[model samples]
Target chain A: MVKLNEHDGSIISVQDVNFYYGASKALTDINMSFKKNQVTALIGPSGCGKSTLLRLLNRMNDLIDGTRVEGRVYFEGKNIYDPHVDPVDIRRKIGMVFQKPNPFPKSIFNNIIYGPTLSGAGSRSDLSALVEKSLKQSVLWDEVKDILNQSAMRLSGGQQQRLCIARALAMNPDILLMDEPTSALDPISTAKIEELIDELKKDYTIIIVTHNMQQAARVSDETGFFYLGKLIEYNQTAKIFTKPDLKQTEDYITGRFG
Target chain B: MEGTRHTSSQYEMELQDIKDNLIYLGVLTEKAIASAMDALLQRDTNQARKVIAADSEIDRLDMELEERCIRVLALRQPAAKDLRFITTAIKVNGHLERIGDMAVNIAEKAIILNAEPQLKPYIDLPRMAEIVRNMIRESLDSFVNEDLETAEKVALEEDEVDKLNEQIFRELLTFMLEDTRTITRATIIMQISKNLERVADHAKGVADMVIYLVTGKSVRHQY
Candidate 1:
């Protein structure tokens, strides 16, 4: 229910939201807000519904069977949960990157241009320009510029992950939802992704779900600590990690309990 | 659950090691201050020598703790609370080391005062050392438990030590003015008191760092 100003469009807002899996509730009375040009990290232990919460933002949860969501999700001041809202259109504006690097079987150029083409962006030159812009935004343009025609699957796991990020950027989404995007990456790759996230925050609103507390502390402006399907604490990332007001948050961050 | 619990246990063990070493340094300095005071009060040269000998261990542990803090900073790249902890560890290590040196200063003054007959009973100097020791212990506990309020309280107590330092200097001045024979002993005791005052100042510095570590606000210049 928290609201930010609309200077840069306020990005996404969740109000009194609830989710259920058949007869069991997965999220309860959740209310949160994310602003444009900032990174908000969702942190909690496994099975804490942090990933579920991320999916709910972009309506990716709609594909899951027996999953029921209630309440409103607003993006750009429009209610995304309205009956007439198209999930495809909503997803086009809000892109997502998964945990594992799942690059397509096509070339690196094709991987970057695939989403824009599917969305019917423009002609070949337009797609090429968009591809270059996206890759450059993700800081991967120079490394793979010579091999644009090569298969993306041949790239290393870290490179593929950055390629996936570039693919998400092609659509020029207003918000990006990343679910443990660097969990499978090595330390060097993790550092690169973290740096990319930092740079991206100046242009796009980012919501990241990370189990690594250090990553949350490093890359996030705000952090929400979720526990047992509830948002236990939400505050500035520095406060959450240094001196959390809640004992549960303190215990979790200090490694006293999880 | 087992894996998570194991990781937490290891983290706790590392934290406990830091806590124990800090307390060990605290106790050693506290004892050195007490014995240094005793040497000045009762003209006990042997106790002053013991205080001097004990300072070497305090110096050794200060280096060890500082190196550990640097290693943690390089290896863990800790953030937030952990980052504050390592940073505070470095500052507190310096404070404790300075406190040890002040104790050595007191012991040197005590040796000189003991050789001369005696200063007059030495009341305020012992009182200053006692307060400094408590400040040392409380500051370390504040850091070990991350208690911001306790750290703030210790910071406030520094004022009393400062006042006592002034009072001791005034009282010794009167004695030096009254008798020429009392001048040498009174001056030496005044130096011992001044060293105790500096130890209290260093202990307050540790307390200030603890407050910063807990609240992430610098209170170095503030009262």
Candidate 2:
């Protein structure tokens, strides 16, 4: 077992981790660390376990049947997979945003406040404050401040995605895990979200899994390249984009092969 | 390796086109340098004028290559070594184009020197020009082959050109001191030697970019 330490700037550390979906393995012997207040991007071809690794961070895979995670994932020096630890508590500290904008059928106000409301977090005024602060953090406050009562489904895809981000931010997570957050977004919206990500990194540790190489290059401080269930290379985003240490990483990023 | 074909054949072709055009540009600049030096040694004003006229094509290709690199950046959004290659291509393109300008500068000075009586026998100047020409060739060859050894060879030749340039200047200085009439023609020859040295420096610049493209490290001012 690797000794886990939290003083090293890393907020989460994965050591000797292997994951399986029933009998088939999905990730193998993965080891890496995510630093505080920095955006780390996980990039690889589709089904290369990049997204699977992102999901493993907060134990989101526990919701899937017949899936097992071996080894330890330390979050702030605590093993999240320990039976004594609560997965719900781990999740609240590490929020997530999905690929598509899956806002609820409720009003936009409800969508932002829903997570806190279910947790009985605070009073009505506190919930309203949380809604405003989360929306502002996601950079969607001005767009939807007047339309709080409108159904979230009525918002555009990009707005809905930002609203989902706001929904996650409402939980006040220390780390935000995004699995291809802007894959479905248009260029303009994507740029806005990317700008928001740059802004949000000052306050939150972000781990993003993206298939868009340029987006990974643009938004990430550190980038990890995964191939066939193994980490091929991990380095500064500039180094990874300009001159990766591994030929397989270079080949994939250059669009030579998947 | 760069030899692997891109999944998008069109993108692969676009990158290949830049390489081809650079090689073509390299050939033109090499010819201009050789011709300019030939004109100087043979005292042929007409050949010098032809070298001057040939620079417009090099300038045109420089603009064309820059636009293509920008297009690839905006469209294909290349990454890793391809990104390095394209960005390096932009820089190497500038160096090659400037090499062309240096050749034209030499040719312009050659025309002036050809009008007057012959200066001292052109021994060191021709040798310097030959080495500079080879520097440009080897630098471009390193870029095309991604060969570090060839790029290092070009860097080593830069010092050789510098030594020859100094040798020519010191020898010419004695002539100007002994007889002031030789000052105008000797100074023009000195300018031609300086231009050749500058061309060698530009070739070294191309070699530096090739090193960056191959190894992802900048060796510009380090040595």
The candidate that wins on lDDT is 2
**Candidate 2 lDDT by residue in tens digits, B61-180:** 999999999999999888888888898999999999999999899889988888888877888888898899889989988988899999988988999999999999999999999999
* Tens digit per residue, CA lDDT, model 1, B1-223: 1122324465545645766787788778777777777777777889889889989999999989888777776766655566677787788888888888887888788788767665577677777878888888888778777778888888788889989989998998898888888887777777777787788788888889988876778899888
lDDT of each: 0.84, 0.91
| Clash-forming residue pairs, model 1 | none
User: What's the true lDDT of residue B189 in model 1?
Assistant: 74
Candidate 2, superposed: residue stretches over 4 Å from native: A1-4
**Chain B TM-score against the true chain B, each candidate:** 0.90, 0.97
* Residue B218 Cα positional deviation in candidate 1, in Å, after optimal superposition: 5.4
Q: Backbone collision count in every prediction?
A: 0, 0
* Candidate 1 RMSD to the correct structure: 3.6
Cα lDDT tens digits for candidate 1, A1-258: 323335334678888888998998888888888877899999998978899999999899999999999988888677888999999998988999999999999999999988888777888898889989999999899999999999999998888999999999898888899999999999999999999999998888899999898999899999999998899999999888777888678667866563
